[model samples]
Target: MAVIATPVDATLQVVVQTGTDDGGRPVTRVRSFRNLKPSAVDDDVMAVAKAFANLQAHPVDSIVKVVEIALTEEQ
Candidate 1:
């Protein structure tokens, strides 16, 4: 049998490590960007994530990781 690829939506989970919060505990912010190309590579996406994250208002925070997620269409 032939293989069929299911259509999916791609998103990047940008995790940023922010400074300690009011409680003096480490904090993290997760931002999701949807509609990315399914062919996007981790390196490429990470580059973009880093650049975008750097330009964000939260300058004190540093990008920890960029995770790609795909949601397949359901019949």
Candidate 2:
């Protein structure tokens, strides 16, 4: 049987800013994207993040942070 080639995917971490810390900075929580396309645009990601963030208890006005990470497999 011929082996099928699959495109490699990266992980995306969406950090949502809910409230401020004691230092008055931003506080964040990480949300992972299991399979993310390498060609994704920041705007599109942010838009989706904002939409998802709405489901959270935090107000939709909270700021969002999107970080892309490579997935590691265990041997």
Candidate 3:
């Protein structure tokens, strides 16, 4: 009989970027969250879904929201 083994992965840094508001103000804010998963797809999907759900439930118009960013890790 043979056994299969799997390797572990490091944590990821999720950087969320947002746009400026209609008031001509810059939203200088940086938020980071940690995930202990090997794949990025799962984390991204959940984050997007949650954000959308919150916006739908609250029904508020925020001038800025998470638009795009890079996914990397911190040493």
Candidate 4:
């Protein structure tokens, strides 16, 4: 049997440093952008994330792409 994976949806997550904890640990928050095209390229997504980050008050810690996939077995 062969299994195939198909991308159904994508999400862009931007992690920003909001502030510091009482213990002085760095605090982070996630900003999620949903309904992105699953076929979006990495460079394009990164570019968009960076542009969005520029509008944010906090500094960006990281950029992540989350994809939802559907798996099916070939008959």
Number of the top lDDT candidate = 4
**Candidate 4 lDDT by residue in tens digits, 1-75:** 999999999999999999999999999999999999999999999999999999999999999999999999999
Please identify model 1 stretches exceeding 4 Å from their true place: 1-7, 59-75
Q: Which residue pairs collide in model 1, if any?
A: none
Candidate lDDT scores, in order, read 0.66, 0.62, 0.42, 0.98
Q: In each prediction, how many residue pairs overlap at the backbone (N, C-alpha, C within less than 3 A)?
A: 0, 0, 0, 0
lDDT by residue (tens digit), candidate 3, 1-75: 344434344343333335468897654433333344444465565575456546442332322222233444443
Regions more than 4 Å wrong, model 4: none
By TM-score, the candidates rank as 4, 1, 2, 3
TM-scores, each model vs. reference: 0.55, 0.45, 0.26, 0.96
Model 3 C-alpha RMSD vs. true structure (Å) is 10.8
Better lDDT candidate (3, 4): 4
Q: After superposition, how far is residue 38 of candidate 4 from its true place, in Å?
A: 0.9
Q: Which candidate is the best by TM-score?
A: 4
Q: How many backbone clashes does candidate 3 have?
A: 0
Clashing pairs in 3: none
Q: Cα miss at 46, model 1 (Å)?
A: 1.5
RMSD of each: 4.9, 7.5, 10.8, 0.6
